[model samples]
Target: MPCELCNAFENEKSRIIYSDAHVFVVPILHPIKDGHVMIIPIRHAENMKDLTAEEARAFMTAANLAMDAVKKEYGVTPMFLVNGWEYRSQPHLHAHVLPSKTNLRGLYAASEGVVGKIEASVEELTITADRIRVHFSYES
Candidate 1:
């Protein structure tokens, strides 16, 4: 299927509260609260490190605009979350915004959202680091 986020932007999905060429702010498909929404890059960035400068700016703009609206309408602080790299769901970069009453707790179960550590011994770390070292060069 075409990516849901891209489809949303192209088709101008009803859930969208704000949009620009590079970003869209829309409610989560399954919201934890009435005002929960996501600020997403329209261009389908799976990770923030992959976002272009234009998309980054647009993401920030959409986030501010959407969060301000959410806070105003809901009359509360808002919680924000971003997942990245292997810990993230792929093919879309999205920031979740949910209204917070006292910022006491999150709406979702901790197990559902928590990312567990990938424990490695020093031997394993050294092996991984050796493989990754080729991507960089030291200053002369």
Candidate 2:
């Protein structure tokens, strides 16, 4: 089967908030909260160990940028979640930058579920993506 992150990376429809040689950052299609985003490596790394040195550094850089943006945008230091194995929704390794009080991967594993649907609309995603991209620009 084709990798989801690869597809997303190649898919023109995907809203990429930030990107570099090693990784690309995008807002999660189904976020636990509004400001939640993902820092995904370009390679199909299923786990942290799979990432090379450059990809790891790029991933961390993306994480830092996403966290900084989330803090600046939401006024809160968001949670960083590294999902893998049975807990991961997708095969590609991606770390979620969540701005919610609740822990995601663990909480989702143990609890009944989250409070409500976090599926963002296309328009919302577009606006959110645009807003986030501004943080990476010198204009911001």
TM-score of each: 0.64, 0.81
Model 2 misplaced stretches (Cα beyond 4 Å): 12-14, 84-86, 101-118, 137-140
Each candidate's number of clashing pairs is 0, 0
lDDT string for model 1 (21-99, tens) is 7877665544455566677787777777899887887777767766666676667877787753464544667887778
Best by lDDT: 2
lDDT against the true structure, per candidate, is 0.60, 0.77
* Residue pairs that clash (backbone atoms under 3 angstroms), model 2: none
Please, what's the RMSD in Å of model 1? Answer: 17.3
Q: What is the lDDT of candidate 1?
A: 0.60
lDDT for 81 (candidate 1): 78
Among all windows of 10 consecutive residues in model 1, the one with the lowest summed lDDT is: 131-140
